[model samples]
Structures are given as C-alpha cells and as structure tokens.
Target: MTTGSTYTLQEINALSHDDFVQALSPLFEGPPWIVAETWSSRPFRSLDYLHASLCAVMYAAPLEQQVALIRSHPDLVGRAALAGTLSPSSTHEQSAAGLDRLSDEEIAAFSRYNQAYRERFGFPFVICARENKKESILAGFEQRLHNSPGQEIMLALGEVAKICLLRLRDLIRS
Candidate 1:
C-alpha cells in the first residue's frame, strides 16, 4: 500500500479503484463504501482541492452511502489504533480516550445514552468530537436522539463530512 506523503500526481492518477481505496483507508474509519466513493476519483492538485471535492462528493452521495461513511467511524470511546486516524491533533479528540478520564458514573451514563441512541437510530451515535468533552458529547447525544430519523441521518452525515475535512486537512498539512 502507498505509505507516507510521497505520492506523485501520476501515481495517484494511475491507481486502480481498489488501490486508491486502500491508500485512503486511513481516512475513512467506518465503511469501505464511503472510502470507495470518496477515493474513486483521484489526481488532486492540492490537499485543499481534494478536501473540497470530497465534501462535494459526500454531499451528493446517496443516503445509504452517506450512512456507510458515518458508520465507518470508530467508536468515540477509544484511542484510534493508527496514528492520525482521528482528527484535531490531540488524544482528547478520541471519544474513548477522553472518556477514560471520566468518573465511572459518567462512563455509565454515556453507555446508556449510546445504547438508547443505537436502539432508536439503528446505528452508533456519531459526532465530530474534536474539542468536545464527555458531558458535551452525551448532551449532544441526548439532544440529537430527539430528532427524526431523517434529520438525524443528515446531521450524522454532516458530522462525518466535518470529520473527514479535518482529517484531510491534517493529512495534507503534515
């Protein structure tokens, strides 16, 4: 697989569909479908352009595809196995890492909220979680659970896009 930041424009352009997706695996934490759609078209002039195009594709993708992207994300409650897997350049951005510092009561409450959210939405709770704390995330979960399925799905997708954008920015900047 292509590793590090040494890809040439021609190399990127020459990648097959599967190769491209593999190279971008670090970017999409959730489902393969999301990475497939996002990386199908390559040959970006710069990272900014790439990020913009990704956002456009995400917004234009089908609902199921969007959900796949959101579902690809790692559970918010743990450290990402790979470096740079999550955005915001801090361990605190990881849901699990941040929650690890919380009291048992807080963790229990978050678990309950997560279960309730999944029961209602048919998927795990989704959040950008860059600078948010455990309390804020749980509050968000509570508030978002009240939204209709259609609305929540859209909101989840938007959060996924934001997470992708942040990660992409960091990828290019590094």
Candidate 2:
C-alpha cells in the first residue's frame, strides 16, 4: 500500500491486491470493478501500461457495462456542477476550462445541447475536459452529434480513456 501526494511507479507496482484497487479506482468514473479487474495484471512497467491495462478491462467488459460506464459520467456543467456536488477531479477540470464560470446564455446552451446529445446517443456528452476549453466542448458536442451511434460509442469510450490517463498521471509520481 502507498499513501501520499504522489506515489512512484515502483511503489504503485508493489501495492497489495486491495491497495492497488484503492489507489487506482478513481481513475475511471464509472465501474469500481475496472480497477479491481486491472489490478490482476500487476507489475505495470510504465504509466502507459497501466492505462492500457485499464482500457483493456473496459474493452473486455460487456456492452451494457461499457454503456453504464459512459452513463456514469455527469454532463458537463450539468446538475452536479450546478449543485456544487461534482467530484473533486471533475470540479477542478471543469473550473480550469471555465465551465464553472458560465454565463446564463452559455449555461442554457450547454443544458440544451447536453439534452440533445443524450437523446441522440443515449449517453451524456463526454470529452476530456482537462484537454479542452469551453468552446471546444460545445463544438465537439455539435460535431459528435452527427456521428453514428457506433462511432459515438467508440469515441466516448476513447474520451473516457483519455480522462483516465490524465487522472492516473496526476496520481502517479513523475
């Protein structure tokens, strides 16, 4: 087990079975099972391996599970953010992109677009918020709306992977 502001790669690679899951569970927004599943493939040689292992678990998951994972993520500037109840990571990422400072018109636009995207895809719009600005997120929502459901599913999962990688990088020491 390791506990600190950051843990070295070696330290993480050496964690006990349960400790490993506890350390990495927050990397994904959805299933807590992802980390436990990933922990079985221990001795990750690098951060990339750690990320790839997680993605593999998600990819190997059932279709319903993958969709559940997608659905697990809150909408950008959605109810959680509005109620000041977003997870710490989400709050920070969203605030960094000015999501927390939206104007009334902007909030309305986001709310409307989020609803439309959900109606079309059956899941919330997802983007790596830390890697994007407010404008790009809105633009992406519009663009992705045109994609087929299959394409959107793949893209959304890929976005989730990117989010997990960024969060994992934060958790692991450089």
Candidate 3:
C-alpha cells in the first residue's frame, strides 16, 4: 500500500468519493467501488465501524461479485511473490509467514498446490498469511481442496476479510 498521512474518521468522511477510494482501496484487492460505497455512510465512530461498513458492502455483494473480489488476491508464492511484484501489504504478509525463505523443494510444492487450487476453484487460494507458517498454509491448501464451491468461496472471502482487518489496524495505528 502507498504510504500517506493517518486520517481521522472526520478527515476520511470529508474526502470526495474518488479521493476516499484512492486512500483506502488498498485494503481490498479490487476496484475502488466497494470502498466508494462505504464512503457514503461516513463519519465512522471508530476504525472497527469503518471496517465493518466496508465489509457490509462486500457481504451484500452478489456471488459473482464476491468471486471477483476474491480473484483479485495474489497466490501464495505465485508469480507475483517470486517476481517481487506483490503489493507492499501482500509482500509483508508473505514474508511474515517466511514464504520469502522457501527452499527449492518447498517452492515446487507451493507452486503445484497453487496451480491445482486455481484449476479447481478458478482463483488464487486466499489466506491470512500474516500469522501463518508455510506448513499451515500448505495444509490449508490440501484441506480446502475438498470443500464445495460455495464453501470455498465463503472461506476465501473470510480470509480476505482477515487481510482487510490487519490492513485497517495498521492504517489506524499509523
């Protein structure tokens, strides 16, 4: 995410819709519209309320929209991670999980699972990698493979929400 000033809720509320979206869209992975929608209900009482409202918009989204939102996320140790092209937040999360230190065999395993997950689910495998280790993430990939499409979609969205919460917490603290 791009660094900028810490914003008061009032300051957030005062921005134009485009400006607000520009400021906060990094918290989510897609176009700025969702955050733009959340902007209308502004003057948030707390950071929690702001995050909740942003999620409210996501929760109300249709199934396809939700899927698109999930698809916006990068795969764990996929091309973006390998090439150092991941967003700052994503790079940090993956590094926190020690993905940046993977051995060759580990990278091979991760790539295999990533491709399989994409084949089955039509999107990257999403997880809140900030607090996870490589083993848990690999285990998650194997376990989640058996889930039905609807379940996987919800699970991915939940992971995405976790990512958003961490981002929000950081932003507010900054």
TM-score of each: 0.73, 0.95, 0.94
Tens digits of per-residue lDDT for model 1, 1-174:
113554444565577889877655555555555557766556677766676767787778887877776665555553342343553332435633375467767757776887788789887677877646677888898899899988988888777766666655544442
Winner on TM-score between 1 and 2 is 2
- The digit string of per-residue lDDT tens for model 3 on 27-80 reads 988777688889898888888899889888998999989999989999999999
Residue 145 in model 2: lDDT: 93
Worst 10 residues of 1 by lDDT: 81-90
Off by over 4 Å in 3: none
lDDT of 2 by residue, 16-102 (tens): 978887777778785588999888788889999989999999989998899999999999999999999987888888988899998
Ten-residue stretch with the least lDDT total in model 3: 1-10
Tell me model 3's lDDT, rounded to 2 decimals. 0.88
Q: What are the per-model numbers of colliding residue pairs?
A: 9, 0, 0
